[model samples]
Target: MQKSLLIALIITVIGAVAIHQFGTALPAYAAFVLGAVLVAIALTVVSNQPSSASNAKYSGPTKTLYVGNLPYRVHENEVKALFAKFGPVNSVRLVRDRKTGRRKGFGFVEMSDTGADKALDKLNDYTFQERTLKVREARTQESSGDRD
Candidate 1:
């Protein structure tokens, strides 16, 4: 993160200098456009670099668990905390309606396989927030589509 920030700062300074030096010779909009292009290029270069976190591998297989019957008010952090009791939670994605930006009463949780199994055993049909939870392995796109 620091490296990316430093690169962005350097790019911004260079762009400012270029604009200042050539502002008199070019139209006002041209200088602004040049700065915008430089910033875009710098961001693209920074984003293309592999993230260090992505290179690390977990000791156990990671499983994506389906968590359904979630209360509409339940958020990602709540789901993470509930699952964290069994094992490390890598991520929690509570699905939401794009148009309304509201929770969709379901979500996906990623954790180690062992943890996922434990969670499924304990949480399946568990009452949470006045609703019975449906915890199980998340179906792959192909399998889910075939069912439909």
Candidate 2:
């Protein structure tokens, strides 16, 4: 918080000095434009820095896998066929739009614990229908709200 305040103070001082120095010499609009540009540059510089908090890794184990980047025409049976080679699949759910009843290009697959691990290892980033698949352990929903 202190660092951000210090940076803001510094930017304000710089912008004020620039506007005061050039406001009389140049047009009034030029001073405002220069202040705007300086503020934008300052914000861009601050936002571009990477922070460690955004690098968190998933720690929980999951038996259900999320399959993404699927073709629109792909069905649940096709997904099952692709994953069946890894192990016995328990269930395959292809998300679809309720109003349109069309595939949503993503789904969830549940399998035995060992089978899920095997499938995740082998199929993650695997190419399907010319697109790389993003297969990962599905995060469980915390809410018990109506999902019908």
Candidate 3:
């Protein structure tokens, strides 16, 4: 339906017609392969058409939120409850001062659904208590940084 896709489809039709017209010059299998390749190229080009959501960086918004400026008293259950309004949460953890057992002022929470995107859109830049939340897709450590 997109202009680019339409153009690609048109080109594919033209190429198919051309191939059929000249296809007798080649062996049957070779002609078949060539036609298949052309069709594949056309589909690939069409599929590359940009989407409106292409600008949406986070693939999963609600799955994991990076909580910053968390109050020392905040618990994992409390955080889960806050996000649960959007969807079920799989897990929540406060990245803490492991030795001191003190809140690290930040943590990560994972929600169960792709609905995280919706939750993120709704809750991003929102204030919980005095701290504004920054919700985003949780990147695997390898992607964001080295885990070790």
Candidate 4:
């Protein structure tokens, strides 16, 4: 645990003990002050806790494949099923338009390394639903700084 968090926990314990022993003996306003201090310590601890977004990036290598030329009416389950023929699929994410929420005709498929390689070789240019599929490794999008 972090040092600041440990210190805050120790302070909280001390405050709880003091309040329990002297709550009634001490003046009403004094008890409120102690309670406020404990609340502040709790808030500090919560704020210091790490956020999920901070750890969103996968640190290790991932076998994520970019799937293009998908039929607009294609479903995520269909994509998963198609790739599952190659290996155990981890996940499938279909791209969509932000405003209309319409399918973007492309998406990503996550699977085992061997599965990804097989899918790339076999699925690329493979016809499905009258469209030739474009299967390849998903490339990290280049960050575009401030748009405005």
Q: Which prediction has the highest lDDT against the true structure?
A: 1
Q: How does model 4 fare in lDDT?
A: 0.81
User: Could you tell me the C-alpha RMSD of candidate 1 in Å?
Assistant: 9.5
Candidate 3 deviates by what RMSD?
A: 15.3
Window of ten residues with lowest summed lDDT in model 2? 53-62
Best by TM-score: 1
Count residue pairs with overlapping backbones in model 3: 1
TM-score of 2: 0.53
**Model 4: which ten-residue window has the lowest total lDDT?**
52-61
Clashes of each: 0, 0, 1, 0
TM-score list, all predictions: 0.60, 0.53, 0.52, 0.54
The digit string of per-residue lDDT tens for model 2 on 70-136 reads: 9999878788888877766767899999999998989999776787899999999999888789998
lDDT for residue 100 in candidate 3, whole number 0-100: 92
lDDT of each: 0.84, 0.78, 0.69, 0.81
| Ranking, lDDT, top scorer first | 1, 4, 2, 3
TM-score of the candidate numbered 3?
A: 0.52
Query: Which of the two candidates, 1 or 4, achieves a greater TM-score against the reference?
Result: 1
